[model samples]
Target: MTYCLGLLLNDGLVMASDSRTNAGVDHISTFSKMRVWEKPGERIIVLLSSGNLAITQAVASQLDDQIRLPGGEKRKKGSTLLTVPGMHAAAKLVGEAVRKVYDNDAGSLQQHGADFIASFILGGQVKGGPMRLFLIYAAGNFIEAGPLTPFFQIGETKYGKPILDRVIAPDTPLPEAVKCALVSMDSTMRSNLSVGLPIDVLVAKTDAHRVFHRRSIGEDDPYMMGLRKQWGDGVRRLFSQLIDPRLDE
Candidate 1:
């Protein structure tokens, strides 16, 4: 299990993902779930993945490999993320990568009684295009984020969704959105062992076509520690101040 989230606000986008992967309690390890491709002034793409580690990695590899192919081969394969015309086209490439991975591995995994499970959160901006965010599922289908729904989560999502639901909006400031993402990630880490530390966070300003801020937050990061403590205490205090329900009524 993992927890990956992306927020699309008017100012820009915020993306975050945890780094823990485990086959069992005894076999736990850390693997970053964030993949980034940047072309400076041209385009910047960030991918957050969750689900079967192997499948996610394979999908990411497909995208990378496609871009490295020679010109003729690349064109035969269609547009790669870097050459895609817009964010929407970039999303289509991601979906195609997911389906390609499924086609190659799903049968073998199912034969072993395992399901082909994977999902991704793709967020970025291409030159001449508005910033966009998408949630790509196992079947290669996807949905774009919009004003009404300005955020998306791809894995172990329930633990971190409430804060986003209450705090995120299309107009939320980029800095505030980053803080909310961290708080949401902390909430999940506290409640679930499968989703954990060493979170990767990326922030991009609209039309910048470059990552504005990026960080790898470890277990001892000072800001994260303070935010965790403050948020927990504030929540407890708020809960205590709430009026108790009238049982007799």
Candidate 2:
């Protein structure tokens, strides 16, 4: 299991994901759940994935093949991540790609007693449009993040989503959103052993349409360490300040 979150704000977008996948108590491994595509000042795209390792890897590989070709097609309409028109179109392309992989592998996977589980949070901006985000399902349908719902997440979301629900607003600043993302990840790592440290974060700003900042927070990163301590202390303080049953005594 893994935890990934994507925040879309008026200022830009922030995304984070942990790097852990476990098959059983003894079969634990590390794999990245984040992917980024950028044209540097032209456009930027980031995808957070969770679910079946094989399916997710297959989808990513197909998308990577289209753009990084050394000598392949003569078609002018060969749309890769770099050339996708906008976030919405890019999202549709991702959906189609997902469907293609599912069609090719779902039956075989089931026969092997495997589940066809995978989902993605796609966020970015195209050169001519405002930033946008979508959560694509395994069935190939997707929903964009609305103004009221300015962020999207997938995989092990319940343990860490409350802080985002409470703190994130559509107009939040980029750095603040990133901070919230790390805090959310911290919450998940604390409550669930499946989700671990060494999280990848990407922050993209509007108009610049590029990955403005990227960081990997390990078990002892200063900012994350402080956040966990402060948040825990605040929670304890809140508990202490609350009236107990003995208040009536």
Candidate 3:
């Protein structure tokens, strides 16, 4: 299991993902679930993945391979992320990649009693276009994040959703949005052992066509530790301030 989130704000986009991948109690491992591609002034793309690791990795690999193919072939097939005309086209490309992976491996995995499961959050900007965010599902379908719904999460999402629901908005500043993402991830980590740390975060400022900030937050990072403590203390303090029903009666 894993937890990944993406927020699309007026200033830009923020994305985060935990590194933990767990098959069982004894079979846990850490693998980055974030993939980024950038062409500096031309474009920047970030993808957060969750679900069956094999399927997700295969989908990513397919996109990578297509992007690296010779220029003529890439253009001829129109399958490369780099050549997509806009964010919407890029999202459809990702969905098609997911379908390709499913077609190739779903039957074999099902034979082993494994369900074909994978989902992705794709967020980025293209030169001469607006920044966009998308949530791509296992069925080769996707939805774009808009004004009312400006974010998306995949895998182990429930534990982290409340914070996002309460805090995120299309006009939220980039830094505040990042903080909200961290708080949401922290909530998930506290409640679910399957979503462990060393988290990857990416922020891109709208129309910049490049990543504005990126970092890997570890278990012992001072700032993160401080934030965790403050959040916990604040929550406790808030709980304590609530009126007691019996006393009021």
Candidate 4:
């Protein structure tokens, strides 16, 4: 289990993922679920994955291998992340990668009574194009984030979705959006044991074609601790101020 989120704001994109994977009480581990590919001034692509860890890792490996191939080889063989002309094409490339992995391992997992479960959030900018964000599923299908729905989430999403729903919009500032993402992740971590510490966050400014900020937030980060405390207190105060229902009257 994990918690990964991506926000598409007018200023740019913000992505975040928790680093915990738990098979059982005793079989827990930390693995960063964020993958990034950048061509400096040319393009920047970020992937946030959740679900069966093995399947997600395999999909990411497939994309990485394709990215490392020579340009002509990549084009001749298939579409690599770098070869995609736009964000939509890049999303299709990711979807195909997910399907390829499912074809290879889904049946074997099914035989053992395990399901082939995986999902991804892909967001970034390609030179000459506007920044875009996508939510790719296990079946080689995806949808882009738009004005009505300017964000996506995978894994333990329910615990953190309320804040995002109330705060995010197309015109939200990048910094505020990133803060919202962290607050979202923090909410998940507090309510769920499966989503743990050392979160990875990446932010990209619109048309920058590169990552503007990246950070690994650990358990002891002062800023995170303060934010959590403040948010919790604020929520409690707000709840207390609300009028109670009077059924008897």
Candidate 5:
């Protein structure tokens, strides 16, 4: 299990993912769940994945190879998503990768009760266009992030999603979006034992065409420490300030 989030912002996109994977309580390991493919100035795509580690890795590998899309009959070399012409095309390609892996492994994995499960959050921008974000399923289909829903989250999403819905907006400033992402992550880490620490984050700004900043936020990161405490205090304060409903009743 893991936690990954993609925030659609006025500036561009912000993506973050935790790196903990556990087969059992006694068997645990660290693996990167955040992936980036870039063409420098042409396009930049970030993918955050969760669920069945093997399945996600297989899907990513097939995408890097740019597998023949049933009829597209074209492929890429190291041809990860960054070369895709636009966000829509990139999304379709990712969905295809999911379908390919599901076809090859779903049945066998299901027999073993592994469920052949995986999901992805893909976001970035293409050169002549605006920024976009998508959530791709194991079924080879996806939906773009929209004005009403400005973000997509996968994996251990419940705890973090509340903060995002409460604080984020389509016009949020870039720095504020980063802070929101961290706060959201902290909430997930606190609530879910499976979603551990040491997070990977990528921040992209519009038309910059590449990642703006990427960081590994450790459990001991000072700024995150400060922000976490502040959020806790704010929540307590809000609770305290609420008028007692019992009096009205």
Candidate 6:
């Protein structure tokens, strides 16, 4: 299981992912689910993935192969992340990568009684276009974030979604969005043992065409610890203050 989220705000983007992967209680491990492709001032592409680990990793590796050559120069032969004209095209490239991986591995996995499941949250800005965000599914299809839906999440989403729904808006400030993302992740981790630390978070400013800030938060991080305690206590206090409903009334 995994928990990956992306927020598309007027200020830019906030993307986060938990690093825990588990087959069972006895078999638990951590793997960062975030992949980044950047061409400095030219473009910045961030992808948050969930579902089958193998499938997601293969999709990311496929994109990385086409993105640049051994010497780091951009590839010109195919529609690589670096060659995509805008965020939409970049999203299509990601979708295609997902399909390619599915075609090659899905049948084999099914034969072994497994399912070919994968999802991605793609967000970033191209040099000439507005910042955009997309949710790409296993079937090579995707939906863009819009005014009414300014965010997307994949995997173990139920526990964390409430905070985002209550707090996020298109006009939310970047710092506040980042804080919200962290809080959401904390809530998910508390409810689902499958989702754990450390979390990877990325923030990009609109039109910057590059990441504004990136951090990996672990259990010992002071700010995360403080936020978790404060949020928990505050929520409990608020709940206690709410008048109890009366069935008789």
Off by over 4 Å in 3: 70-74, 247-249
For residues 2-115, write the lDDT of model 3, one tens digit per residue: 999999888999999999998888999999999998989999999999999999999999999887756646365445887787889899999999999999999999899999
Candidate 2, residue 165: the lDDT equals 93
Name the candidate that leads on TM-score. Answer: 3
Q: Is candidate 3 or candidate 6 better by TM-score?
A: 3
Better of 1 and 2 by lDDT: 1
lDDT (Cα atoms) of all candidates against the true structure: 0.91, 0.88, 0.92, 0.92, 0.87, 0.92
Alpha-carbon runs more than 4 Å astray in model 2 = 70-73, 246-249
Taking all chains together, each candidate's TM-score versus the true structure is 0.95, 0.95, 0.96, 0.95, 0.90, 0.95
Model 6: how far residue 143 lies from native, Å: 0.4
Error of 1 at 114 (Å): 0.8
**Model 1 C-alpha lDDT per residue in residues 158-222, reported as the tens digit of each score:** 88889899999998998899999999999899999988989999999888999899999998999
> Which residue pairs collide in model 6, if any?
none
Specify the poorest-scoring 10-residue window by lDDT in model 5: 71-80
Worst 10 residues of 2 by lDDT: 70-79
Report, for all candidates in order, the number of backbone clashes: 0, 0, 0, 0, 0, 0
Q: How far is candidate 2 from the true structure (C-alpha RMSD, Å)?
A: 1.6
